[model samples]
Target: MTCKKNMVIIRSFKQRPVCSECQMRSLSGPVSDKKFKKLFDIDPKFYETSAFLRDIRYQYSLYQNLTEKQIAAFKRVVDEFKNPKKKQINAIVPKAPTKEEQAEHKQKRAKGLFQSERSTLRALRTK
Candidate 1:
């Protein structure tokens, strides 16, 4: 009688947990303590990444400086992450103003002041 070889089949059904990059993207927007806790509860390993931890620390540093709207936007993004259907590979996060916006804003302000001054001088001359 010939011996029969055994056949083994392996089935892969489980998905790997979210990676650090994904978790960090999930936290990109501003978050409150409650939202922070919720995220930590979902994945404690999120803070394992150095960059993610640094960002969290940086955001905290400005805890008192952020406007209500900014904080709310952050909360909304975090909430999206909490829900599985809304989870995405790359979330759209709001960014702060760039040097260009600052420069343009300054130029606009200067132009407005100059126009106001010119109008005042014209009025004085007419009177």
Candidate 2:
């Protein structure tokens, strides 16, 4: 296997191989602002919906103060969540599937045993 970041032959675990250096670096400490931004380019709704943030808010409520670095990190996450990069916008936009492809997907889905009653009815109708 190869490293996702550098495409070098991974010298890490076989289950989920990554570069040894990359793995070590990731495990060391808190991610940098630029790295954090690149990693978590999620929907703006995430700022409101994140469970981690909820936990942090609860902690803050009890403590009344967070460290400067923690506050800065929170602000950074909120800012990034609110305004996703242009590259992320393009990357996230998936191409529309054709009607034939959609039909094929429905057919494939219908063949599965574990599905809702609605799907069962649709499968029957399709037949």
Candidate 3:
């Protein structure tokens, strides 16, 4: 039941060959290779996020050597994050009003004013 005994038993059990994984677990407790890989597996597009770069910068600040070119590159990256590129929006432009429409609007306004004046005159006459 103990790991040391399990390792010894595993070593003796040559008839039913213990897998390397079982040997490792017996020696070093339960360690999942899949979980380890999953934890450290970096995506190809991870650099684009800048988070991975930031982590690296934070973790290995002492190891960093910034030349003029490297400093410029870092500045560019910082600028990129500070002022991100704007995506082109498909904006709907309103159609300009035609001369005919302007004329029609003027006529409507004039008619409204004329009707109001006529109503006031009628009211005055009746009084």
Q: Which candidate gets the maximum TM-score versus the true structure?
A: 2
Instruction: Kindly report the root-mean-square deviation of model 3 from the true structure over all alpha carbons.
Output: 22.5
The digit string of per-residue lDDT tens for model 2 on 11-126 reads 55543454444544443343345644443444534534554443344345446456777667776767766776667665689888999998988897888644676788999999
Give model 3's TM-score versus the native structure: 0.26
Looking at model 1, residue 37 earns an lDDT score of: 49
lDDT at 89, model 3: 55
| Candidate 1, 1-127: lDDT as tens digits | 1113433232454422444455455545555567454533434343543433434434654562445665565455555555748545456666778999989979978779768888999999999
Question: Which portions of model 2 miss their true places by more than 4 Å?
Answer: 1-47, 88-127
Winner of 2 and 3 under lDDT: 2
What is the model-wide C-alpha lDDT for candidate 2?
A: 0.56
- Mark the regions of model 1 whose C-alpha exceeds 4 Å error after superposition: 1-57, 86-127
Name the 10 consecutive residues with the lowest summed lDDT in model 3.
23-32
